[model samples]
Target chain A: MRMLRLLTVIMLLFSVAPTITAQETITVDFYFPTATATITNPEAGESIEAVFNRYAAAFEAANPGVQINVVYTGSYTDTRNTIQTEIAGGGAGPDVAVMLTTDLFSFIEEGTILPVQDFIDTMPDGEAYVADFFPAFLLNSLDEEGVIWSIPYQRSTPVLYYNVEQFAEAGFDAPPRNRQELAEMAQALTLPDGQRWGVWLPTEGFPIWLFSAFVIADGQHFVEESPSEVYFNTPQTREALDYIISLSRDYGVMPGGTLSWGDGPSIFTSGKASMLFHTTGSLTRILNEAPFEVGVAFLPSGTAGEDGTGYGAPTGGGNLYLFANSTPEEQAAAWAWIQFLSSPEIQSDWGAATGYVAARRSAWELDPLASLVARRPQYAVARDQLAFAQKEFSAYRTIDIQGIINSTLSGIISGATTDIEGALTTAQAQIDSLLAEYR
Target chain B: MRHHNALGSRVADAVTTLLSLLWLSPLIFAILLSFRPPNEPITNGNIFFGSTITLDNYRAAWSVAPWLTHYLNSIIFVVGVLIVQLVTVTMAGYAFARMRFRGRDTLLLIILLQLMIPSGVLIVQNFATIRTLNLFDTHIALMLPYWGSAFGLLLMRQTFREIPFELEEAARIDGASLWQVLRHVYIPLSIPAYTAFALVSISSHWNEFLWPFIVTRSESVRPLTVGLSKLVATTDVGALYNQLMAGTLLVIAPLVILFMFFQRRFIESFARSGLK
Candidate 1:
């Protein structure tokens, strides 16, 4: 009886003890820029978590010594701010970060991110695989100093999403091919009883990309060879601004309540608006959730003498960056994960899973997705827009000045001051003041 | 006319009850949401209208972080803070009530000034102080700044003054020292006041998020408030809503249970202490 009781106590002790005594797993911290989303017991290839799980399983299976822990911090901006603070404080931050290349230049200048070329050079198949990505995607991933930094994983550009029913109602067989057609179609599409507008722009968050495209389309320069100095005060930019403003005030074809925090895509999806100018990444969301049939159109053309023949959108996507602080072995492991993730198969699978266009050119040739893209046909518009896309080369203190741009852009739309020159002047002055520290 | 008066009063009573319920509706919704499945999207249809519920949210909430550790750390923080506060406030209250000293009224007024100044503006300064003391990332860091509360001192002073001087005189006649007089008579009589202060201090510290989030880096030291933020940030409507709601429910469950357990004592102490 005594022996049995002693045995039972020993068993209890053994069961309660932590199992960290063996060969410790190499924990690689992966910081993802995403807000949490709930998908119910997700089906295979149907959700982001499902795709993440597949990658994690395959990576872990290949490299048994490694255990990757994913922490969904928040949106792109939130993760950038958090990482900045963490780096400043000299704490144990993420070993790897997968975030947008739109903010890459600023992060590189601030020295928050470390270049991964040296890590890539030591890899067996890195040279060939890295070459598989499009040049534009690679350029977006490069730092201002022309050093290779992050690897492009997922990328997209904005396309015009139009309501098919509204287009038919407006007596148009297809999406408008030019700005003049779009404007004329907008006038035709506007209905009194429906109160549905023709075109809608987000009053916040997306204005920088749209404004940058406008500046480029109008043949105006933001800055000379030096990325500093304000140059957005040209006549061409003023004309572009006037055109967009007229789309709202003169045409009365833009959705109302945009200035007061209403969603443009939701408005488009719910048939409150006839058209929405947003990312191709929104394609899957609109396809999955919108109550009406949707159509894709090229971004509007500018007036003559402007580079308005084609829409000049920026290539926006998340990149996989390996941290410099990681051990040589850990770096190798992270590279392996990155390579696995960026492969043609994975890219194709991920693109099909999410709405994002794959960074790889080879992904377009894959079956089912290839067929889908070929059939829907308009999905290929993102590829064409990619040719004109430009990445942002924000100043060293882009973050502090980013909020200023977002606020000032919103201020422009609300007609708060109605002075484009004054807004640009004040923005320039603010940017200059911010740049003083970096200088 | 009698029927009309009766009908009007009944309608008035019904409207008042409805208004009370309308005020409580959000709290009721939070309670219901706490039991929802983790990761389910909440829609308008579900907001005022769904009935399918489960305990998975509660279970997920329980498992999300080192909640047991958070609860233990919270208890330690509240008890430690309360113990130190009780001693300081009692002595300070006794001094303010009985002793006529130089700058006494001026000093009390200065202390009361702390109540007027918002706590938010002091965060950066408090963080610097906590850092200087090597108390950052510790439960003590959270408790230290709030240990000697001005509000508690003022309340205790009022309660002490309400008591007659005869109690202290009786204790003095028994050859009791100043310490003994405070310990035996004054302390015993001030139970209601101390209880009122404890309820407030414990609940506030238990639910505080920002200061704790700023100070504590590790999950081990974080309180329920900071832990719940992780769950909130994770809960996008299309994913993890159930888990977020579950975690929120778990965070409040202990406090709710605690409040219920001490509801009678809480009401009595507040009533006796005369702090509405």
Candidate 2:
């Protein structure tokens, strides 16, 4: 009698289970990293996580039978490490992740990420969608064959942040236009007794980004379209290096040793440094924290281009990558989430909130960003500089190659090695060997 | 000679005080920074004190992550690991110290060899094992890999061997079963060793980040370290040191309180167990 009762319960459970399973929601796990913990929408006052949740909620509401599980993976490095571990463990990692734009080659080599071009090709407005993003921001997202591997989300370029009061006091009506003027103004603004320096070019953690600007302004591409090629030891690159070293050693306007990247904002805002070479992602913070009026401009150029401004910068930030490890349904859902994030409306709100440059050119025409740029024109400087911006230095085995370049730059700048050409040549050889496998 | 001895002692005390202050400087800075007003950064010549102390950093840090769930998950993870570790380590320690068996030394040597292997290299394999067991993203998955601690086993074995063998013999002669002998004789006398091992196990596991981060996906299973990491901004954007410090204080407060409450016992246990 007990066995019969158990059999009846089992039969009932089987009948009910399939109906429940039939209505199951497809979950797309989305992982992202924030620029800072305190990222808040200035208008709505929503926290970063709350903003993400709101987007997910909106997306879910639009597309029924799909759920977006947003995970706050730490920094870009941590997110990459987590995904790598997940893949190694034979588990499908997050359906989508926000990784560094330079991480494109490594992920491509790993075969873990699916090219978004596959999804784009199927869309009716694919060409228009691809054309809408800022060309500079999309530079790092494309491969040698020009296939789009990722979608630009949080993007930024390094801009010159100068103290307005200091610039005025030093009798400067405008920010420096060229390297000579930059040094002259920096020297004039500098105070004696080490009280204040003219400029603080942070060299401690990844100095390659700003340094690449110098290389670009001097009419040399830092890295070619090929993943295995880099122009680290070129004459233009050497001239850029010598000019940077002279700013500290001969000009006595910048710091002498390895200036910490983490200290740049505070050092500028605190009036310890008159000008700062830092990311536009830090624009909001610097503007908010500066007691004096903050001035933002393009980084001084080494040589003028055809457009008549030698001004150049390298775009640096994260992009949305879709993993190949998901189901077709999940991939479609993930692609939709990426589009929703990169859409003009959302991008404008995100840019105003977090100080990242909106990847889409159309996002600038939207309300919050348009009004904000109107109120504070510093926001437009990064946008204008994008015309002269180039891809951040990226190659096969990017992290290791970046490490070599960073250490070599640090060595020369810190006076550990006065042989700038020799050090860079060695670094170039090391990078070549590391990239030889890819070639 | 008496005067000279007093002078030497005075110098020693002064040196110790200097060393202690040096060691405490970073903590002092963190505490000071945590309370500093968000507008007044240390670079503004406010290294020690800002114009007005505020809880804004704490408030901002608190709102960023789910701290309550993180604390609960951390407690469950550390306590769970410690409880199982005590059982396994005690039994293994007893077997190695008192039992007679073939290849006992060889088995013990192999187990001890795990102490030399860095836990980082085992992350992928352990993660695979966890996935195979269908335990990923669970609290048990966070604690599973640490259950059998080689260091704990080795510490317990050394501690057990130092005990007088006559105590165990006497208990056995009195018709005490192996379980009774262990419970009444070995365990009670090995309180200091057990306490020492427990502190080491709990603190290390509590502060663990990589394994928990790799294994868990939900806020319900992630620990405090993972939560603390959310406060770290990317290097490009300069750090918000004030909020980072505040978040750190929140994550470490429980450990600090535990250590303070058990200060005397912890010191005595370490001393008695011959562990630094």
**lDDT tens string, model 1, A212-259?**
666655555453334344455567667766767777778777743233
TM-score of 2: 0.97
* Candidate 1 ranges beyond 4 A from true positions: A1-24, A39-54, A102-106, A124-127, A154-156, A220-230, A255-262, A304-308, A364-384, A436-439, B1-276
Candidate 2, after superposition: displacement of residue B24 in Å?
1.3
lDDT of 2: 0.89
Estimate TM-scores for all models.
0.72, 0.97
Q: What fraction of the genuine interface contacts, i.e. the true contacts, does candidate 2 reproduce? A: 0.58
Ten-residue stretch with the least lDDT total in model 2 chain B: B37-46
Candidate 2: TM of chain A?
0.95
DockQ of 2: 0.67
